[model samples]
Target: MFDPTAFDNIKFMIQAEVYDRDLAGLFHVHSRKDLVDLATLSRESVITFSLKDSADLRVSLVVKADLEKLAGELLPSSNALPGVSLHILYFGTERSLMAERMDLLEWMWGTERRYERKKIDSDQTGTTYEWHVYFERIITEEMMDELGDLISFIGESLRTVTETE
Candidate 1:
């Protein structure tokens, strides 16, 4: 399950640079009011309603040369970066049911051989077959965790095979 509240406090930083004065002409068709309106709606506080509509969301411009000075105190370089990618495979009983419930498909069809019991009448019963199939991939924390473990297992298996050879 994906939780929207996990990112409630996260703040995103964006910086843009325009090289030439002629580039400023590109916005000639858009009035200053249009730019202000767009920016007002895009601000984190405004979009999330963290603050009132009157709150200031204006960003102060900094010269490229000044960025180095600011970076020395505010940002630090990292020696190593973490590399991780997650892949999820979702499974459901029926294609139509999965599509209706989550808009996904059934994957690895006809794998399970188990049969389930279903009631046909008060004195009789019937057997029903079911298989877990997945059509789409969903990215979430739980799925990522499972993917990480699966990847680790595959990596270890490959390493062992190569070492023996």
Candidate 2:
């Protein structure tokens, strides 16, 4: 029998939730990548999407699991367990209100996650910003049920940050 890793399960759950929203007309799927590093024996998956009405802002959900995590789950004597780190990234040209938006995201994601914003590129016209929300702890299979709520919160965050204040 073949078994799926925690990373695989979580990635599928996230994709299903996002694609469901795409089908319902709330969001549009842009790009997706599922990669495995043969040398490191690590896995990473990224899914990018945008709000239905706004294509400028791109949101990406990334899930990654390294070899140590996978080995821990596969080996019965290992004390460590398998898990994936979840990161949500936003790309857009909204420099003026970035501070406020970061604050709003911090509040929405709470204190467990670390947030960072940096200018990825800039030109005379405007600057492109990338905001990343990194979940501090490893997300295991037990936390699978939170996938839907996480997607919902992300949607709420999109609305909150883009709205005129």
Best by lDDT: 2
In candidate 1, position 56 carries an lDDT of 16
lDDT of model 1 at position 163: 32
Listed per candidate, the RMSD to the true structure in angstroms reads 22.1, 2.1
lDDT of 2: 0.86
Which lDDT tens digits does candidate 2 get at residues 46-153? 999988887777899999999889988899888877899888998887753377777777787788768888875556756787889898888999999999999988
Q: lDDT, candidate 2, residue 124?
A: 73
- Compute the lDDT for candidate 1: 0.22
In Å, residue 150's CA in model 2 sits off its true spot by 0.4
**Alpha carbon lDDT of each predicted model:** 0.22, 0.86
Query: What does candidate 1's lDDT look like per residue over 3-102, in tens digits?
Result: 3321121111101111111144311111111112243322121111001121111111111112232233234573322121122222122321223222
> What is residue 41's positional error in candidate 1, in angstroms?
19
